[model samples]
Target chain A: MRCAKRNTILLLALLLTFAAWTSAQDEAPYYQSADFNVPIIAGWQNQSANEAAQFHKPAASATIRAAMATGADAEAAAAADLASWLGLAELTAPVYRGKVNLADGTWHVLARDIDAQRSVSQVARQAGDRFIVISFLESDPSSRIVMLAIAQADETLETAEPEMDSALEQLTGLRLDNLTAAQARALPGGEWLVYQSETALVAGSLFGNDSYIALQEGTAGDLAALADAWRGTLLGFFITPDNSPYLWLGITVSLLILAALAGSFAWRARALQKDLAMIEQLEKADAR
Target chain B: MTQHEAENPLAVRPQPRLLRALTIVSALGFAGTLVLGLFVAGTDIQQGQVQRIFYIHMPSFFGAFTAFGATVLGGIIYLWRGSEAWDRIALAGVEVGLAFALINLLTGSIWARPIWNTWWTWDPRLTSAAVMCLTYAAYLMLRAGIENPQRRRSLMSVYGIFAFISVLLTLFIIRIVPDTIHPVIVGASPQNAQGAFEATSGVVVALLPSLLLWLTLMPITLMWHRYRLALRQEAVDALKLKLLGA
Candidate 1:
């Protein structure tokens, strides 16, 4: 009777412990909507009238760099200014051959005629200047040119010029002054047209756009560098995806633990059976 | 001889001390399992809090299977060696297995309610587990209907061995074929595409202890209960002999 009472007390204690453990295992919420975002730009589009026949091909490419360069303070500021205008908190300014700014939420830039024989579209726009360039690249060739009106800045061009130059230098290796654009009559296939701010420029292409040659003109080393920077940014966001990885690990471990427990019980049953057999044999011997 | 004397030929058998010790240990182990289980957090990447139910559901199923396995093994031994001890152990194991299986089914349904968006599913694993539970239940009912102890033990032992084979088929069939209905968790598959696994150090710390306790406690408790049952049978036999003229 004493042994039975002790067993009962132990059973009660075990039950209490189990209840406490289960309550502690209660789950907590880990996913939130703010953890992920759908990227807006699926891919880039190049619009060049000379390559009208093969406009569907890849037209241009631009090198994307971090805004944290040693001399990129000026470029970073200008990128920040543009980003602010667009209501984007996180923005990385890419170096384009032309001066670009947010014009009523749309990117607008003006290119001046660098060569006397070349048209205004052939030359990249310089920093801190205003000029007339109303051609907008539409994916549909049949669509009419939508002339975008440039809005006058509240500040003078002289004050914004230095800031824009610094921002461009900081973001892209080439200073805003060195940026230039050129028009080629070949199909848009191989040329890399980079749209950094709002302004798009034709850099160079491998095959004409008609042939669908997607090669962009750049040293392999430079492409690798740009890819590295993009990868770094992506890594930061991977840790905090809407479905966090930590939670998955927890569930897996729990399953393994349960399996182990089952195995242990099976082992114990075997041991107990041996003991029971011995006791039964002893009882039978006493009866004999 | 009286009916009681005829029933149990050995009524004065002494209970073993080892059995009592196991009972104490098992009770303590069970307590520890419950405490640890409650404290561990059940967070999952995709299912959120609903995933915590996995811990309880899985262990219960595992415990039930373990008990069932013991029952079959005990039944085999009882038939081969013709030992009453094996018969008693088989009976106890089956009873405990049934209890745990019932708990497993209930907890699994509770878990499925929030995650699978339903209270019950006819998924292969769930169906098989249910069938296995019902079959054993039938085994118990059949035993109760019989009055002859020797016949009842022999039939139950045979049925227990057969039921174990059914359990094996139930557990392995879904693994052999693609189960389109119920999603697989933990293993690599499309079911894992939704990202429903995660384990942190804190969760491991809490769950491991609980599992250890359950593993230690289950067998000890079951064996103790079986011994007590045997003792009660002996007591009934002796009392009947005292009342009847031999």
Candidate 2:
């Protein structure tokens, strides 16, 4: 009993020591988010009405002739002249012109004319890929404008490929161009292309812009998937040339270790408790 | 007689003169360390005055860990050797660990506000410490839940061992992995590098004495109270047995 009493006193002393240690630490204040702002161009508008009106006017016959004077193909000249008259800064729009080939069930054109006084009329055909163009007398130059806007789809699909390619190369260290035919075949359907140029028109009346020619085509699910695939491949390249197995193995091993440790500690504790109980029972019986 | 004396088989032992003397010395040590910790320690070049909190924070962590360690060792002895003395030690250590853990957490938050620029971070050390405190608190509750003294002690001893293992893991786990959330404790700032102490003789004079005093006094105070508690528990057990016999 005396020994037990001494042990009890020693135990109490240890506790008080711990308490004193805890109380010694200082309490400080907490900090929160600092106030700041990052400026991003949310929207823009063309303030010049004259430039907006010029954008609205149809391409003139004289402008088309002058554009074609360099002996450019008629379709190319038409697109160039229209682009130049519209002051289209982006050089990416492809020029395509074909007349309706009534004889062969295809569109064929012969001797099309566009000049300074002519307006370009554009009609999207019912068939997804077909478009019709009719040249007419130019409307008032001051009021005429080619209203072009960049749509969300144009942003996602048109500009995505080049960004995806660069991101993929950074992530995977594999040049997109270097992928072998077999490797390319193995990838989910979609071919990557770099954006050369793009142009849109801002008219006087419209609040948003409009794209004249947005060039991009791929059959992958969506822009996000393309981004993910690029990121994964890049990360995978760093881990291993072939990384699927390593990722799976790493996850599996960590979970297994955690589970084993938890289970063993629990089991041992329970076993110790059982033995202690048995010892106590035996002592009680002996005392009785 | 004090109210506790009514239920205690062994009345509160009169405060021993030697113990009281030691306590006074210990109190002096605690105060000295605190003053030194606050004023004399060189300001962290990067963290400035906030870094002073480290003195308290680190010691509290050490104290809590030590207490928990004692609990585990005591628990193992209680189970293997069936020493009630070990059980008493284990109980005292757990209580002490709980108190220190609380201090560590509170002080850590105070320090965190200025340095990490947030009151709380999901940093591994902080999270693990919190978990450890909760686990030990659970151990205390488990002990309280049981009516049988032997069962409570046995169960708590096992819990104490498990809690110690968790504490070890908590301290070491973050080091082996990447954790962006918690700022690295060591080499945290290049300007205020490790052991940023610029102690004059006066500061050291005050600090060393305070540390020694607190270290010595804490155990004395706690042990004194624990002795009283053990006596009460013994008396209560005896009374129960006597009543049963009657």
Candidate 3:
């Protein structure tokens, strides 16, 4: 019977493993570090190493880098990160510096033209002693592309139009009405609402009721590509909070409680032995 | 008196080979499952290391469920057959069941501290679980307070049967009450589930063994030990009474 029971347990273990394998959902590909995670952008050269998640697009002449930097503030941290990657001395003051507040935190959005070919756009926010910086660099001599994420103007009505218009006005000092609207284009990432003029091209995608839009100038047709990549990283990347202390605390308390329960049984048994000894002494006195 | 002691079901005897084996197996299995949950499982991408607490938090509740189920069964049988053995089992269930319930309740509170950003909430599921723990705890207190042996056994038996309702409520309240932040691992979670993550293969593999061990072996082994302890306690009590009369 015991052998049969053992065989049944082994069979059940096998069945459980099979069920788990079948039931498990396909986990999305993510570039994970001890501190954070970002979706691995498809068709990009993965240049990530150490503590950072970085991806490069040779076709678009762009490299997207997400990392942490030590500085006094968000803007300083962003500048520090850009300096390390794009050669700090070669860059001048940003053409555009603005701030956008999202669900996670307030982000300092800055755009810098590094010499003539390379242009860098960054979003930085302070997280504890360090700062989280995601920089989008386009080294193409022909065109400039800027990627930005902003909270939706209206929560109930989610369309990329308002944010697209705002981006055009803010980035190029032009209205949305100035640009001709193209047919809604479908991509592997999601639906893109594209707007372009003679010089500037704009494309935006909606994720979690927020607008992730890309602005490009010159002869580059990589607005759709940049928009898709930005949408993937900006919307999905999350800093996995360091909460291991709570886990350790939970484990320690559980073990302590279990040990106490076990110890109580032994304590009671010792007391029982003492009681028996007392009973024996009393019985001996009465017998005498 | 010796004949009466021989007739009593609560009489002390050498540990049965089956019970001894079960105790060893259950202890080893409990340790093994804990190791699996702590080390073998992959860290959740979303919730981080704190998510590991789910392995213990969920299974410990089920452990309480099994123990309390035994209590209800013991209660019913004791009532029907008027057997002291059944009453001893019922009493053992309350003590052992309460410990598991406490583990479930406190581990949840600790987990919530990091995830939900709060130590405690009066959500329907949380409230029901707390009330369930309290109800079983009250069983132990009331048992000690009652003077008459026959009366205490019958009263607590009825209490044990009714208290099972709290366990059921705690188990299913998240479903019955639509507005909740508590995430379900099986089906679609509620709209407002805080710190929810998908149950991937790693979660399932770690959870399955722990679930099986807590459900079957741990409670049964612990309760059987408690049953023997209760018998020894009763025997000592009877000796004290006889000595006082002499």
Candidate 4:
């Protein structure tokens, strides 16, 4: 009866464990890659592989690709990545090039016209021996939207107003004064201050002492949605830390201790054998 | 029975069928659980591959718990019945439990070096665990020092029973102190901000089997082998005395 009760308890435990293993979540909430991990864009199609994560929005004709590239520095890494990503032998210089220091590192932000139909806006930063480049490519020919990340001019400014004024004048071909009063709009990434004119609409969101500004040539595109997506991607992206060496060391230590314990048992048994043999010889000598 | 076996009932005997079977099961279960921990579980994006050590780290603690619990049981029973076999079992438990506790300490320290940014700390839980290991280690040294057989067994039995207080302290010190960065395995998140352990399904599957194997099979098999070796040592000591006396 006791043995049966023990078997029944074991069976119950196995059953409950099996239930937990089957019912629990199998997938993590984010898309994991070799070089990094990023939140899966809810409505976008995932086409991720190797050290890169790519999300495509067919409706918007926009593709966001975050990847690890190797080169001399952030600028060179961004250029080489564009060359390989778009398969172009020679490329023209970027229309806009700047740098911003964020929580992780200094990022080099660049905007370029890949061709008449293709435009690419990318940010790159050096990570360890390589560079992490995140690009926003617009394939729609009719869309003449320009996106740029600008550094904050002052530490005291509560908003990215100074950078927004610059982005508006430089990208929209108009001064900030030409637009109406700045209106604050709460968005997914953060609070943004948007300025609008008769011909163009510009929006800038403040994040980590920098301004991520978007300017659409015409007031027809959903730049707010696009900016939210960009913020989500940027905020969610991070390089997975590698602490595998410590894991290997831990395993080595455990195995060695266990082996030593096992070896001690064998050593004792062998010594007992030698002692038993000596006892038998002593008895034989006494009988003789 | 042979003359030697009849004269000394503690002579070497053939391995039991149940013990032999348990040994086989323990070996295979260890291999299977290792594969599950190392391969089946996902790498933590925050801590990366080093997080896999947790599957072993948590289970080694439970293994030590079982071995120490056995020592307590053996001591109590030996005191009640005055059986030398139970005293041998109590001693075997100490040796086995001490080895497991060392594994637990060594692995946890190595893991903490990467996660907690330090190889050692004076946290309450860790200090108590260190003291627990040292207390049991002293039991071995004290047992060796005693020359009288009955006195050694009686004194060590009492020592083993009291040393379990350290295990109790190690198990509950986190609650008493509340400042420890060491993780509480159940019902709450870890105190250390950096050493977050997310219990994903894959990690659970690996950890459950490894936990069960180490908690039950590993300690039992090792202690049984140790117990048999102690019996042989007793027989050999008697034989040496007989020869020396002549």
Candidate 5:
């Protein structure tokens, strides 16, 4: 009887371990947007919520990751989206690869690899309502093919290529590796940096237009390892947009102000000139 | 003195040669600051190239502060003595302050784009600055709307004094308030900071006098030009009134 009870306990323990393993495998980290979601696996990071955002992994080397959020008044939302598109375009322009339409019809891909830098590669695509960008940074010699997959509710990509290419040309040689966390923290205006490290930094508004999620991953020591580590910490972290909203709002308002100022100055000068001319005419008439 | 200056006290007067020479020196000083700030300052190790924005950005704040300070002084004196000269001085201060404020705000935005990953945030310092800019802008509009000279000067003097509070708040809000994420660039300790950079001794040496001279020269040149404009406008208005009588 004693042997039978021991055997029963061992079987139960085995079953519990199996359950835990399955659950871990099933858990997919994700950031959701209005149109779709970008799902990351167990080790990817969730750094989202900015009108524009930058994500970095502290353990990873220097790399630039940016996104634009959707879900605001249409004009502001468009502005936010444009900002992200411009950033990605600039980032990939120097090492532009070919553009191809995927079989899915809803997803379009642009592939790029840096000249002479075998380890650097970037993939930018439009998936559904979100523009998804993935870049690889490994200065060391490694040709590991990394994959950043996205899963979403409504996946769709359409015809916006020619305009995108023209805009991409405007992005002439922007260095992706130079920005630091400290610099991200010190910026004024209502933008925020979500995370920072020696080699990586993430900055964006936490309350941006509610864009999609991005997952980073791959083999160890490369960019994938960092993304995996970031994903591991996502559940434990609670973050906000680090910038003051007043800064964002103030940009448009200040433009209007400067315009008014110029107008006022012009009107005053013109009016004064007219008054002077009228006075001179009257003075000559009186003398006559 | 010219006949116009002798006959009408409000005539536009030519700038004195010494003042013009000083203005020339100030222009040279501005050129020197641009050279030293862009080239001579060492690259910040942490922030990289974007850190260069601080050289001009901080000086612009100082320029605005100087102009704003003059506006306050001019306001108090105009109220106490009722001199049109002080009123003109006060108006000139506002215009120059507005120009410097714009420079301070725009350079900050450019710097923030790379470092902060966003173009602007309404942080405490930035918010206070916007308020100050709007307040002065409204002051200019108020002056434009008023037809009565005495009333316009008096109202603006009072308005200038009141608007100065925003400047003070902008300068001190980051220090007194703990809510700001904006790092203190002037009195920061060795603790790590994002968007914070150290100006090397060389940078500091180049930056200080350049900042001071920039503050001093911007107002002197701009105010001198503005005052001349105001004087000529006044004369034109008086001549218009005389012509109407004729």
Candidate 6:
């Protein structure tokens, strides 16, 4: 009977764990608007958010680093600044002669033949100084670097391109307002945001030799919520429970040790009780 | 089997004096390892000061490997001879081995970040190690969920023997597989590894004994304590049965 009871409990525990794992897997990929709303592409997981929100996709398996600028001319200013950096460094790499303008009117700076099989691209824009820079390089599979391997192993830049575009579009659409350092720091995603000053909200993600940055500006409430939602969307994928098994193992072991000690003490007490009762009974008989 | 015997169980099994001495020695040895690893070891030629993490990383891994191996040996003895002592050893080995395994994984991650530039990757070596850690944790959980003593011991013995496969896989996966980015310092890797290095004489001096002494002392100390605890629990169970029978 005891064995049967124990087995049932064990079975129930296994089922409950399975159920929880399933539910975490099934959670919607969309981040509902509490402070702000963002829908992360499926297969991504959020790692951190502050100055920049780091989103990693397990399938395309690339990390997207985002920062924001809510200043007056965010997109155009960011683009010109990046263009200047690219111009200076362009001569060192195998360069393509002309710039390719995207359908969204943003220009792309592509560095051709960086290695035998890889290229680097940076896209940036500014209206006044509300600028965001999204940069990535084609990861070569034969690269010795692990980060490059992860970026290039099976993840094609083509698959990640759409996700990047969507992120840029959402970021570009926001209206940013200036916040004091204290105000910015007080926000929910304050610590994770890229720049925590009164001017620009910039976040940067650096992987291997490449970096991706996003800038946004707006009300402190909206800025915090947006950063947090993007973080949630990117890091939403479930691989395992956050709680470590070692934690449960430690608890179980400690309890078992305590129970073992207590059981021995209890048994010794029972034996003493039995001996006292026997002595009293013998003494009563002797008196008679 | 009498009331006197029941009242005085520890009299039959005197506490081992060696346990205390071993505990003290192991504590002092560990302190020495920390001091030597931190202050005595020279900066690595390739990895700089961060390479110091290798001292604890290597020893803890070897310690975990040895503990798991001991668990296998204990399991085999229990299955063949059916001695409760052997079963106790198996239980003790897994618990102690598991602690070391965690240290190995944590320290490995700390080492990987600056060198590999990533906290974790699903390379064969790392993946296999993670699986090994999970398997042993399941072993403990399996023991905990069972109520029947004989069945618990029998099943754990078999599982303990089987679980060593993952440990072997963790150790050898990088050697066998060509695609892994994990560094193989002692032997050849088909692919270039960013963090592979030659261990200097200073590293060898600190590493070899740390591995041997920790593998010898840490598990022995933990196993001794667990063995005694198991014995006491067994005595209590026997007393309960005697009381009912009387």
**The candidate that achieves the highest DockQ relative to the unseen native structure:** 4
> Weakest 10 consecutive residues, lDDT, candidate 3 chain A?
A19-28
lDDT, candidate 2, B116-154, per-residue tens: 557676666678878888999898888889998888889
Number of clashes recorded per candidate: 52, 41, 0, 0, 32, 42
Model 3 Cα displacement at B182 (Å)? 1.0
Question: lDDT score of model 6?
Answer: 0.55
RMSD of each: 18.1, 22.3, 3.8, 4.6, 23.2, 20.9
What are the Cα lDDT values of the candidates?
0.46, 0.44, 0.84, 0.83, 0.54, 0.55
lDDT by residue (tens digit), candidate 6, A206-282: 22222233333332223333334333332231112122233333334433543453364456555644654554455
Computed on C-alphas against the true complex, the DockQ of each candidate is 0.03, 0.03, 0.55, 0.57, 0.05, 0.02
Model 1 residue runs over 4 Å out of place are A1-288, B1-21, B40-42, B180-207, B241-246
DockQ of 4: 0.57
Looking at model 6, give its docking quality level. incorrect
Q: Is candidate 1 or candidate 5 better by DockQ?
A: 5
Between candidates 3 and 4, the one scoring higher on lDDT is 3
For model 6, chain A alone compared with the true chain A gives a TM-score of: 0.26
Question: Which TM-score values does chain B get in all models?
Answer: 0.80, 0.79, 0.94, 0.94, 0.92, 0.91
User: Candidate 5, A15: how far from true, in Å?
Assistant: 78
Off by more than 4 A, model 5: A1-278, B1-6, B189-193
Q: TM-score of each candidate?
A: 0.47, 0.42, 0.87, 0.81, 0.51, 0.47
> Which model, 4 or 5, shows the larger lDDT?
4
The residue ranges of model 6 lying beyond 4 angstroms of the native Cα positions read A1-288, B1-14, B243-246
Off by over 4 Å in 4: A1-25, A47-51, A57-61, A70-72, A83-92, A100-106, A113-119, A127-130, A138-225, A241-245, A279-288, B1-6, B114-118, B121-125, B172-185, B239-246
lDDT of 6 by residue, B13-99 (tens): 555688789878876887777666656664443454566666667777777787888889989999999998999888878877777
Interface RMSD (Å) of candidate 5: 17.0
For model 3 chain B, where is the 10-residue window of minimal lDDT?
B1-10
